[model samples]
Target: MGDDHWLDLDTSKYPFPNTLWHIKPPKEIAIKVTVMLIVGIIGIILNSIILHILIKNRWLWSPSNYLIGNLALVDLITLLLCPWFMLVRDFYQQYVLKHFGCYFEGFLQASLLLTSVGAVMLVSYDRLAAAGLTPDARVTKSAAIKLIVITWIASMLLSLPWITHREYVERQWADYLETFCAEDPKVLGIYWHFTLFILVWIPLGLMVVTYGAIMWRLEWSAKKLSSKGAGMAVSKAKTSAMRIAACVLITAVICRIPYTVLIYWRNRLSNEVNSVEGSFDAMWFAANYLIYMNCAVNPLIYGFTNRRFRKAMDRTPGIAWCKFGSWCCVYPVYKRKRILEVDKNTEKVFVIEGTPRPNRKLAHVIKNILHINKETLDFSVKIDEVTTKPTKITPLKI
Candidate 1:
């Protein structure tokens, strides 16, 4: 097993005096690898949790949520494919992955980046439509699915250049053969500029426009309402929506702007300086860290800002186990039971739990059984006993 002559390659082509194959990773490279590994692990876990929550909960299956789920999926794929390869390339002097890995990594990164940007734009537009239009005019589930398919297709088409231009090359040093993957420098300059425009500027522009319009429309609707109560409700809703949108948009810009600037700087420098080293620099590390950090931060943003998502996460069995221990793993049997309560004055019917008690106040009965707020329940009400099975009760007119 130890007699492996295949490993003993000729070193005559190497430029260096020493012929040692092993090279110790530099401090900067080690730090970059560590940070990237940490971020990738965090991103993978967070994205998986987001996808799990979205998939497991039937109530969260809305058109908007579908797009959000797609974004999470994209980020998850990006973290899985891009970062590890980048870390490997940074740590190793010679590219271990050959031509296939080069093309695959390049294509995957380009396509996913575009898909993520497109998804974010679509989400912003979906929010705009929901805020400004009637329920009938908002995007439907079918429409959102079609949009997602189109985004992926478009991203693939846009990323075709990566497949065409990327190449695996080997150069000889004094005592080592250096291998690396790179794109056609001529094509990279033009292609990357176009990608930057699509990935950063366009999405940023759309987010601002869509979210701004939503806020304006909300404010206008609030102003048109005559009742102060209605106005306050609208104001409250606007504030909540704005808060979520602001956090998402702000984080996106902060994460992407540095990477965009780094690319721009590199492209400009490449034009002037005949050659640039493939080794990672401070700017490269920082830019990459921010971009990958975005993936981990997205789940945090949603979990923190969106009350519904937080509530859903709380109800998730896995999360429940974490919070409440192993006892939460026991599934409770739910029996179909409902009580019909009719308000005497307003004639409004409500579905309550448990058996009706004769001569007892409706609010008191509901408070004891369902633990519902008494203030929301009508004091003057009549209860009608219904069968303890899944059945609808029509409201009786008094």
Candidate 2:
């Protein structure tokens, strides 16, 4: 299109008011900044505790845990750095004019952003493996550690270009500073294709396929176990996995889908599109941030849906009060012995108290199958006599 024709074309095609910069007044900006700061701090603290549990509890180290740890580290960095942007957006909307502020904001934004994309990709694969596991399957610790390293490295490399190419320019009509994050035609063309394939489409697409298979498998198990008198455990697992898979699907749709579509269009219409005059930046920020928040939200899914994470979070004091819905009521289990005397018609039976729900169910099933129900009683009646005879029982007060 010629310049005259382009000028004649209505600019309203670019919809929505552009209020991303100085949209809110100073006071409002402060409030926004403060809220973001507080949330970021809490996220960092909670993610740190998650990392600690995954590390200290050797038994919990698995491929899924490694993905979660990498995500937490990404969130930690984002939270730590976002407050500076919050301050600038609040107190110094025009601070992009300052060279230091410009580079800092641009670099951190790119880091948090590209890292987030990579982290989500890793999480998608991790969840795929985790969800694909057989009822008794688990991803090994060595594999998990290796994947975690790969996730960090991939994310770092993806974000490196932004750090290297970011520069500041002047825009006469707009704010004094124009922060142009490097969008090199050739380089970005390659990156767009590469990221779209590996990070955007492949990982998310695999998640959809993997989770579908997992749900199908879990549903099949539930159906099979229904007639086997397996109680609620199988059903509960199936239900939990289904919900988590749904959440992941929703997250991918809301976060990745739009960006992917926009990027495809942007690539096709490269020079044809001069500038984004609409609410693109705002929507982009919202979508991207929501995706980044998924890292924090995963811990919540674990806390609510996965019993082990809930128990660990309860014991982890620093993160217990974050109100991310990961809190649980936990009673400390202790080992103890009781002195007892046995009599005829009574057998030796031990009750393992304070066991988790899954273990409790399994233990009860095993005990019932073995026909061993005794409270420190003597087996003097007869050989293989499965009889329930209650004798005098007194509580030993603690």
Compared with the true structure, what per-residue lDDT tens digits does model 2 show for residues 1-398?
Answer: 01224334444444422344444466756765665655666667667777766666665565666767777777777767765564554343333435555456655665565666566666665565555565445556686677667766666666666555544533332333223223455565576677666646775777778788888877787788888777367787777688778887786676567767666655554333424423554444454455455555655543344455555555555555663333232221211112122333455354434333544587777865444334334333433234567533333433
- What are the per-model numbers of colliding residue pairs? 8, 4
User: What's the TM-score of every candidate structure?
Assistant: 0.73, 0.62
RMSD of each candidate? 9.9, 11.9
**All models: lDDT?**
0.71, 0.57
Best model per lDDT: 1
Residues 1-398, candidate 1: write the lDDT tens digits: 01123125554554544334354358766777778888889888877877888888888788988988898999899898888776766555567889887888778878988998888888778888888877887889999999999999999999998889887866566556766676676787698889989978898888888888888998898887735446876887788778777887899789889888888677656422213344425567677778778877876665434545655666787764443212322221111111222223345654554534644787777665553334234433323222243432333444
Candidate 1 has a TM-score of 0.73
Candidate 2: segments with Cα more than 4 A from true spot: 1-24, 31-35, 55-59, 82-138, 169-182, 189-199, 227-232, 261-278, 302-304, 317-398
